[model samples]
Target: MIGEPMPDPRRSIIDNLNQQLDAFFGAGKSVQVIPSGVSADAPFFGTNSHQLKLRAERDKLAPAVRAEAAKGVVASVAAKNLRMHVKRVTLIAQENGFRFADNP
Candidate 1:
């Protein structure tokens, strides 16, 4: 087992993000419906155990690998934000009587 190669840490984070987004927004639907009069101003970023583990393990990697890992984290966060924004925009547009082409 000692000879087994470990997986890239960034891939795990990306997978986790994708799973969470799918669970929230559903597969293939970038946007979700929010009931009338509900506000959507929740913040996205949070320091959690997963991040702490990444930070700890990151210190052990080479500088070049660490840099790449940081980029992965940034990209993952951006993708997540984009997904949430789609949901928010859809909810707002719906409240204003605009229907999505595919949804309507």
Candidate 2:
């Protein structure tokens, strides 16, 4: 219990981001196709959660996602930025059901 180390929240957030980027990033904004590979917008970050373990890894994805955005799509977002954006979006998703000290 006390001796057990808590898992990284960044890792958790990143996993959830990958899972929900479709909804969070908005429709028709995916940069890459996934799974079936039918050349459509999907939320794959050009990589996986393991690669997203550090700040450098998170920052490394910015350009690619931004490039997609420049092309009117959003394929892969960086982890930290993605995490921040996801929080903001989910807040809206919950219809302002959640709050924090900063918001209060």
Best model per lDDT:
1
Q: Give the per-residue lDDT digits (tens) of candidate 2, residues 1-104.
A: 99999999999999888879867567657575466655445547644556445435435544444443344322223223345464433333233233222211
lDDT comparing candidate 2 with the true structure: 0.47
What is the overall TM-score of model 2 with all chains considered together?
0.21
TM-score to true structure, per model: 0.26, 0.21
What lDDT does each candidate get?
A: 0.50, 0.47
Give the number of the best model, judged by TM-score.
1
In model 1, what lDDT does residue 72 have? 46
- For model 1, the superposed segments whose C-alpha errors exceed 4 Å read 27-104
Which ten-residue region of model 1 has the weakest summed lDDT? 61-70
Clashing pairs in 1: none
